[model samples]
Each structure stands twice: as structure tokens, then as C-alpha cells.
Target: TVIRDEVGLSLDKADKAVLGTAAKVVLTKDATTIVGDGSTQEAVNKRVAQIRNLIE
Candidate 1:
């Protein structure tokens, strides 16, 4: 909870579990399909997507 006029950060365990499941589903897909042409932009975007899909 937030104190009066103050900001606080907290991690929700439930959200993490759900995101872990979603990442496993997304990252298991073929990288080639996600990044066609293998151009510079495609490669960069693919790498970023892979990083985001990581659970931790």
C-alpha cells in the first residue's frame, strides 16, 4: 500500500506466475516465423522480443 502522498513499489507473485506461463507459450514459437527477411530491424526486434519473453 501507498503511504500518504508517497510512492511505493511492490511485486505481485500472482502476476509473475501468469506472465511466466505466457512467456513459455510465446517464446516456444519459431524465431524464423517471428522475424522474416532477417534484416537489421527484424533481427533487433526479434532479440528484444526474446528478452521480454524471458521469465526472469
Candidate 2:
């Protein structure tokens, strides 16, 4: 998704530890909808945006 890619790009210059920490934050925030069976693609995209905003 666009938001995910943007976050990844923004974190490109981050050290591995920082990136990994960011990844954990992103995963934790998005985990529920991402792992839910009824979650739509749009829901996933919104979650990505939420995670991106948190990191940025």
C-alpha cells in the first residue's frame, strides 16, 4: 500500500535497530485488522496510514 511504502521510504535512512522498532510498532498497531478474517483491503490500507502517521 502507498502508506506502507512511504513509511518504508522514510525509514530507509534509519539504522536497523530503529527500523526494526518501527516495524514492531507498525505491526502492533495493525495486527488486529491485519489478522482479522473480515478485514477488507481498505481497512488494511487505513491501518497502514495509521501506522505511517504514528511513525512519521
Candidate 3:
């Protein structure tokens, strides 16, 4: 489960179940990116389509 808020900061450390694993992560001052391991490709595709629909 991904914690989508600052409340996640309260945790000293999160377990793998709480924080999903990924191949790579890139963090910038304004953004954080996670490269998944393809296990959730279908979910990703669905989310991308949702975003595209919202954008259009």
C-alpha cells in the first residue's frame, strides 16, 4: 500500500508490504518517481488511461 500523504512520515520505517518494491526510484526537490518491476503493469496501464481521460 502506498501512503499518499505526509502522515506516512510518522512511521520510523515502513515494511515492504507497506512500501512496494521497484526497480529504481528517482527523487527530485519537487517530485518522486518509482520504476516498478512490471508486476503491476496492468494496474499501471489502467491508471495511465484514467489520467489520460481526465486530461482530455
Indicate which candidate wins on lDDT: 3
Q: What ordering of candidates by TM-score runs from best to worst?
A: 3, 2, 1
Task: Name the runs in model 3 displaced over 4 angstroms.
Answer: 4-14, 45-56
Cα distance off (Å), candidate 2, residue 46: 0.6
Report the C-alpha lDDT of model 1 over 1-56, residue by residue, as the tens digit.
11222234335323543323221222445552232422478766776786676525
TM for every model, in the order presented, reads 0.28, 0.35, 0.48
Report residue 28 deviation for candidate 1 (angstroms): 31
Worst 10 residues of 1 by lDDT: 17-26
Whose TM-score is greatest here?
3
Candidates arranged by lDDT, highest first: 3, 2, 1
Candidate 1 lDDT at 51 equals 62
Which segments of model 1 are wrong by more than 4 Å?
1-39
Clash number by candidate, in order = 0, 0, 0
Error of 2 at 2 (Å): 20
Positional deviation of residue 43's Cα in model 3 after best superposition, in angstroms: 0.5
RMSD of each: 11.7, 10.9, 5.1
